[model samples]
Target: GRRALVAGVADDNGFGFAIAKALAAAGASVCVATWPPALNIFLNLIERGKIDDSRRLADGSLMTFERIYPLDATFDTLADAPEEIRTNKRYAERGDFSIEGLATQLVADFGEKPLDIVVHSLANGPEVKKPLLEVSRHGYLAAVSASAYSMVSMVQRLGPLLRPGGSFSSLTYMASERVIPGYGGGMSSAKAALESDTRTLAFEAGRKFGARVNVISAGPYASRAASAIGI
Candidate 1:
């Protein structure tokens, strides 16, 4: 069986890492796509043996990743990224490491239909601490683009990359429905779009590629991702 690509895994404590751990424990080979800026840091932590104990399995043995790829889901293509970001020191080694580029890299590395599952645990809200009324248009749209459209873009790009009966799932929050006081900066709207696209993608992808799409509405946990709410 091919490996599952778990995108957005920056550290051991995030939902992405936990999901990857669960998949590996269930007998799935797991590969992770990490943001280029943080990829080196993550590698250093793993190499220096500074790993987190929370990632331990029930049997007590630590999990391992089959492979790691640099990825940034915010921009589908390199041309869309800013010049400063493209020229950054951390991103210099990774060529075209966006979602679109990840698909291309996977094909070159594993041939077509290489993934059985894609876990999209990516989300970013620049103005997450700002209230809706205080947020700028750019901030609101950025949240939607990163948190919602990234999933849609990945589904579109991975249609050929996913094996038959493959599945793609993303993480959402309860803020998509009932409003949480501090879940501001249009993050709630972003989750709403993510969930809506999940349902739509399920039908569209299932019909065309024999694939499935879904989003998990996760509750609050101590993962680094949840800390963005400024609690």
Candidate 2:
């Protein structure tokens, strides 16, 4: 009825973009939440016509987004962020895209209206090429933060922002269930945590908010972020 907020779109070829376009074609307004540093580049890509939205659908129509927001989930509150993280090389360049920032922005713009769908398509594993035993604490935690805990944080913050019977989906991997060689550096563990939390959230959030929470365990696909991890 309203819009689906698809998060973690780095580019048009990613799963998030595909999902957004599909939702738009189905007559749902689509808004995207992209990593802040890449927000400008994403906007530029759309502006310069680098991303084509003119592919004929099965019913012969075009699709496009209604809005795009910058989103980062590390800090629930702007004040909780460390100065170093706020002023970090890449993060500093992007403005407020934190989870709280996005929530605040949505409330300011939509006035406490609930969303219909929320998609969580974000993940990261810094030392993905390394084995779990070889992974450092920072790398492991980073994977958990970006991949696993973000889902929990999303449900915590966005659950209230979702309408009754709204659907929430997050992307996981088969790695959560089965080990894949070279899928290392705690990536599997991150996915495991993600899957575990998905079920937990399904129960908790379903009871509390009358919403549906599920996860799609996606097969490996070639993506910029995936390629960076050598997947």
Best by TM-score: 1
Candidate 1 off by > 4 Å: 52-55, 59-61
Clashes of each: 0, 1
TM-score of each: 0.95, 0.92
Looking at model 1, residue 29 earns an lDDT score of 87
Candidate lDDT values, in order: 0.88, 0.81
Task: Supply candidate 2's per-residue lDDT for 58.
Answer: 62
Residues 139-224, candidate 2, lDDT per residue (tens digit)? 99988998889888888888888877798999888876777878887889999999989899999999987879999988767778
**Distance (Å) between predicted and true CA of 151, model 2?**
0.6
Tell me which residue pairs clash in candidate 2. 72-97
lDDT of 1 by residue, 1-231 (tens): 657999999888888988999998887889899989899999988887788575577888878888788888898988888998999989878888888899988898888878999999888898988988899999999999989999999999988888877999999998889868888888999999999999999999999888999899987778776766644
lDDT of 1 at 164: 77
Error of 1 at 32 (Å): 0.6
